[model samples]
Target: MSAWQDDATRDLMGLGGRLALLVRGEGSAVWDADGNRYLDFLGGIAVNSLGHAHPTFVNAVSQQAAVLSHVSNYFATPQQLELAATLKRLAGTGEAGRVFFANSGTEANETAVKLARLHGNKVGKKGLVSLNHAFHGRSMGALSLTPKPLYQDAFRPLLPDVTYIDNTLEALDELDWSDVAAIFIEPIQGEAGVVEHPAGFLRRARELATENNALLIVDEVQTGMGRTGDWFAFQREGIVPDAMTLAKGIAGGFPLGALVTFGEASELFYPGTHNSTFGGNPLATAVGLAVVAEVENNDLLANVVTRGEQLRAAVTDLPLVTGTSGKGLLIGIHLDGPHAGAVREAAHRRGLIVNAPTDDIIRIAPAYTIGDAEVEEFTRLFAAALADVNGTASEENNA
Candidate 1:
């Protein structure tokens, strides 16, 4: 019997099914408990920025843990202060900004929501806006901003005065933004089949938010920290958001999230407004500093662009693949039919890890350090999996 079938296993909330019991991982590859090796393209759902056990990340975490791991928010640590400054510098906000640390993207977003609400209180605007397919987080405030019915239906009675609109310039023009407090958007929607915001859409949102006195909150949990070939995907469009939430890859697999605020939004919070006991602790921030250094020193941003283009080119023409979407390592392969699940299963049998976010979409977020040979190998395995699935479908049709 499988480990999952054990009677002692608790029926806690989780993803649909357990795929494999991973025992060890290193540099974009993992080995299962059963001794099968698999190339990891999902990267812990885009959390493993530098891949498993990178020397820099490993050393930093190890050394920091030995010294000091956790310190209450009442006290200050040099690592936390340095990490916040580094984030501000990377954002180009300079001294006009500040950061709030949390343990995950959801908490970071919760902090952003609080900031927006406080800012809105000054102008008497309590409403919030978000995209139709946008995903902020699963917390009550963030969930209210998220537009997915499946996740929001049971969590009814979410935060009130939140509106969801389609990601289009026309929709923006039609939006009644007079009462809106903030507009939350993902530069590239990860959970919604990797849907990207349209060209000039972010700029338009910036203008609308300014006109309506609403805060612009960009959720960069999946696209930030060089995941989209740039330090942040929103940078490509050349628009500055009042506040941005970051997580996933921020600390290169460490559990850390940050809410960075710029301009007037930076001073929205006062003493006792918000705090986290474990946020930005010595261990997490120390590793975060190291991750930023490695990404810059190793010049992984250039590699991301080159490898991203190469991957798209290699997969777009494969059999059954209708098209490929997204930028950098955050890629989505659209199949011509509802065969994404079958294709994923076939890839698994062949020792590859991928994610089917939707019935027709396969999302791939390989490590930023993935090499040319690994990409080529993944493409070969994926093409073979497509052929196997297509062949099986043909047999079923004839039968």
Candidate 2:
């Protein structure tokens, strides 16, 4: 057995086995402990926006660590305030918005739930609505909105009154808006194999939420930070959510999450109602500020569009691939058969890293900094991997 497998403290909580012992990373590639290099198409499951070991990110974190790392919520740091302002500006809520920081996406969603419940308590609306096959987080509150039974059935009795609706307008139209406290939706459902909300679905959701006097919360944990060719996925839809949860690429892989609320929802949480010790530490926020600056200065959002198009164009025509889905760098490949796992394993053997979110779906969330050369290399390796898997399957059938 491998050393990681033999470790006593390692829990096999559904992650079956260790894939590789990655020692270091740079740009869109990582090297395993065995000294093998692989192009990281998974991008840490859409976390490393600017790619690994970005000099700007490294310098920001280092400088902040050398200056001030943590100060708790009692005393606010300049970096924290600056990050809050920057996020508010990016969210397009301007000076009227407020931000609450957290350590991860789940915590951000937890905060959103609290804010929704607080708003609901005031207005006597206690129900919540979420789309089916949506993945917010693993926390009890976020899991309540998440519709997958496999993630929730084990932990029964989640937060009550959460209704899971389909992605269509008809499903949303059927909901009695009077009782709903909030409607939580992911602009692009990442964990559901990159499934996108149908056209005009978000706009209708906004209208419904407004009609019911409920909050509209967009969980942009995966789709935010230029993953969809925009700062936030909702921007393309041209509707602003009342509150949005952000993480993943927000800090360019730093452990940071934020809940940004617009309009009156910004004042929902009282001073003592919610708190996080390590939420907006100077080091993390300093890195966050740097990431934001990097995204703008380097024009990573435009890069996301270019690279996404190049990748989709390269792969969509492959014999094994049925089609490609998603915007920007958060892409998914639909296979003609249930061979995503086989293809992923084959790609790994060929020094390419990808994710099989399902038996038939392969997710590719490469870094925004991925260049045309890297995309071409990935396409070549991926096609070879598909051929290898297909050849193996054909031999098995003949045997």
Candidate 3:
């Protein structure tokens, strides 16, 4: 067998049966071993927010590597401090915020869950609540906070005192709020087909948590950093979570994550409570600060808003499309039938890229800087795929 085939065969089967193409990538494009170039709509599942090989990101990483890279948690680094300051400002945490850095989304969420529990203990609460269809992370702690059974079923005996609630404020009704440690939620349900909680659901959750003395932890790992055309998605909802976990786009594809806490909640993580050896490494934080600066200076959030409207408008009138859900660039189009996989395959054949988490929903989280022409191209290609599938069905019926 060929080397690539051998590698594929040896790989684990944990990816839900979806095999990936081995490719060489460059800004918004990837070439398979067979020299097929595809426009990458997936963008490493929304991690490459700055596209690929962005000059600013490249320069920042190079410069920081020359200066310093890793320092143990015992010592402070200027890059880490600067990045934390920038994030605090972006998150609107004012002067009362503090940050704990980690190396990935799961670690970031792990930190958030731990801090929530600590805060709950401080206030004498006992339980925690998260929405159904939510995905926080894969670690035991974050996994416990994740409500999806399929993801959690395999790993039983997760942390105790974690409960699942519906994605509506009504789900909070009649609960003994006094025992709830905190209410954790994602701004947008990225993995569960981009489901969004109802309007005012977040605000109402905040109100309930405050009334009952609980913390509100917003998992913005996938929805923050202009992915939804805002610094943070919760800002648009008019609610500020007590604690927030961020990753994915924070470092523009570098492995980095952070937990930011405001008010008295920042004191939950006392010294010696938690630490990551490579968490706030100079290289990652330096790259992160650059990503944040680029986002602000280039006004990429504005671009996300403009391009999101174009992409949504192009598909709003399609017969096969039921509707598009989400805000800004993190969009999900619901289709009339379970043809998401087929449509995605067809788009791939046509040198386009997309994802299907559900049988009928196609998730489109392309880089925020994706151009209008690319969006138009994807819309045309998707429409063609839909028509082709319908035509095939009609012919089969006639035969």
TM-score of each: 0.97, 0.97, 0.95
Better of 2 and 3 by TM-score: 2
TM-score rank order: 1, 2, 3
Q: How high is the lDDT of residue 227 in model 2?
A: 91
Query: What value does the lDDT take at residue 29 in candidate 1?
Result: 93
Report the Cα RMSD per candidate.
Answer: 1.3, 1.4, 1.8
- Model 1: per-residue Cα lDDT over 268-366, one tens digit each: 899988999999899999999999999989999999988899999999888889999999999999999999999999999998999898999999999
Report how far off residue 109 is in candidate 3 (Å).
0.8
* Tens digits of per-residue lDDT for model 2, 241-357: 999999999999999999999999988999789999999999999999999999989898999999999999999888689998899999999998889999999999999999898
Look at candidate 2 and tell me the lDDT of residue 61. Answer: 91
- Regions of model 2 farther than 4 Å from truth: 8-16, 396-399
Give one digit per residue, the lDDT tens place, for model 3 in 263-290.
9898788777899999999999999999
Better of 2 and 3 by lDDT: 2
Off by over 4 Å in 3: 11-20, 393-399
69: Cα error in model 3, Å = 1.8
